[model samples]
Target: PPRFTAQNHGNLKNEEEKEEEEDRRDILAHRGSLTVRRWYPVGTVLAGLYSVPPLNEVVAPPPGMATRLCFSVEYRHSCEQLMVSLLRLGNLPPRFHGNIMLVELRLLPDDRRPRQAKARRTGPDPEFCDCFVFQVSGVCVPQSTLSVCVLSVEQDGKRHAVGRVLFPLEGELGQAGRVLWRDLETEDDTQVPCSELGDVQISLMYSPCLQRLSVVVLRARGLQLLTDAGVCVQVSLRIHTQVVKIKRSFVAKCENDPYFDHRMTFKLHSQHLDEACLRFELQQPNNVHSGERPPALLGVLVLGPFMYARGPQLQHWMDMVNTPQEPVELWHGLGRAT
Candidate 1:
């Protein structure tokens, strides 16, 4: 018995490593806890296919001249497994053109809420089909208000106002993927006349984090139009920077308050960050009206944060009155305890 091997094989290997750490704390206390749900698609698209005339009859840009719109959207995914499942779920936003995808172009605020169905998957497969084709151009800033709220659209029906065009900032309407109002010759310019800027009620809000794209411009009431036309609308807010070449910028102002509300907050602090392209301009100083052209409200870039974490998670527990079970006082004799 005294020859029971090397110290009884180190006491049976420390009793099988304390029984595998108590069976991994009884299988992590019986597991279970994980629930994630995500869906988006909010609709709105009614400019009557570019014939321009019915936001009442366009006459809202005489205060300080501000309305030069150019909005564009062209997304086509009839198949190819839903564009490779929307480019592997990054929601396709980069180069994205043909099998088509431009996704967003901004500037809107009549009442702001046109698009519909911001999200829906309900888990299990859900028969996918996504389609979109929106095109907007500017130059009707009197009283100013242009909105196309389709946050997510492939198909839901009920977006018909079709009546506005011929303001693509005056010229150049060929590039952004091509759609030049039938080669403009000059029928009042080209197209602009459509009514029914009504019936827009869309709602679906859930935020863990990630919803930044808030642009507001309100000065219509009595319209002094930027302080009685001393003229100063120079507002520029361009976004899309991950320091690739370095060109960061941000500025805001409407002055003297006819009405100005601008808020653009996009968050995605990691993966090197950068997916919120914005470009706003209202310079206007060639003596006010060189030839009448300032009415642009292009907007639709809403991808907010819901679960972006590079920081925020710490839990260290172990204090029990400064933890001291056997260290028995080093200065316990100072005044001798009772």
Candidate 2:
């Protein structure tokens, strides 16, 4: 019998399963739609969420941020559940694992930190009319996103990410005080698109033996300057929550291709490399592109798991994190181009 609620409408079921469907439908009818208010004095009860300090510690969002995002969540979709055979030997009667699916939702507070909820097992297509508020204070709402994934539970208690939806959070969406019946998208689970604005060549080296990290700013090419005014390149590094700005060098008589032969090293432990990231940024005092767009960012390139990339990104991850001493020189495209 199909255990999920939103299954194939054409699929036929037995008498008992049909009776169960009627009962479930009656329950849903009794339950009304979910609504969240501007001020939830009792958020814990509305969301049905309770956690101890060790398990659900309230980790604040990053600094240099403004505005808090508040939103509600619910799911409506049909997914496949794998039932592992319990019988080890063929002699025993085959046993089918019960139909069970878990929903794990992630509300990213920032690029590096993600606020994930405890997995909720709600059969198939469990639409909780009693919605909960997901509040991430002090975050860039437009930049952040919400990810809900369906997982199949095997008899052995193993879970697999089968299908999911990635939805971006914007300020305007919350103005209505509710997000009603949004269809989840499953496009490789990436919400934002990464652009190849320009190219940058950087070298990375790590020594677990010495617990140190080093990077050399080779050069930048194919860059679009904001204005004819002189521009500068900011070479920097980010390790976990700590940010080390190596130097800000000015490029005089700036053109598209500017050569910045600079190098920086950080005293990093082998463990810190897990959260370490390298960045290349361009800046200018004035706007050059007339009537195109505001020149907030001339160009930016990021190297870390925080920024999503497809296909060769897997190879890029391996070369950047694993391959040491080789000094892999790869052409990195700018993520945000002005």
Highest TM-score: give the candidate number.
2
lDDT of 2 by residue, 1-338 (tens): 87867766456556657767666665556444344222223322544355444311232222322211222432211221111111010111112124344444444423233223332323322222223344444334456555554444576765443444455655534334333233333323322333445666566667677666666667666766657776566666677656865556655456666676666666766666656666667766455457565434577766655443332222343344554554544455666743
lDDT of each: 0.24, 0.47
Please give the lDDT score for candidate 2: 0.47
Give TM per candidate. Answer: 0.17, 0.36
lDDT of 2 at 40: 24
Going through the candidates in the order shown, the clash numbers are 63, 0
> Per-residue CA lDDT of candidate 1, range 149-198, in tens?
11122234312111122222222322333321111112232222111111
Worst 10 residues of 2 by lDDT: 84-93
Residue ranges of candidate 1 with Cα displaced over 4 Å:
1-6, 21-27, 30-99, 109-338
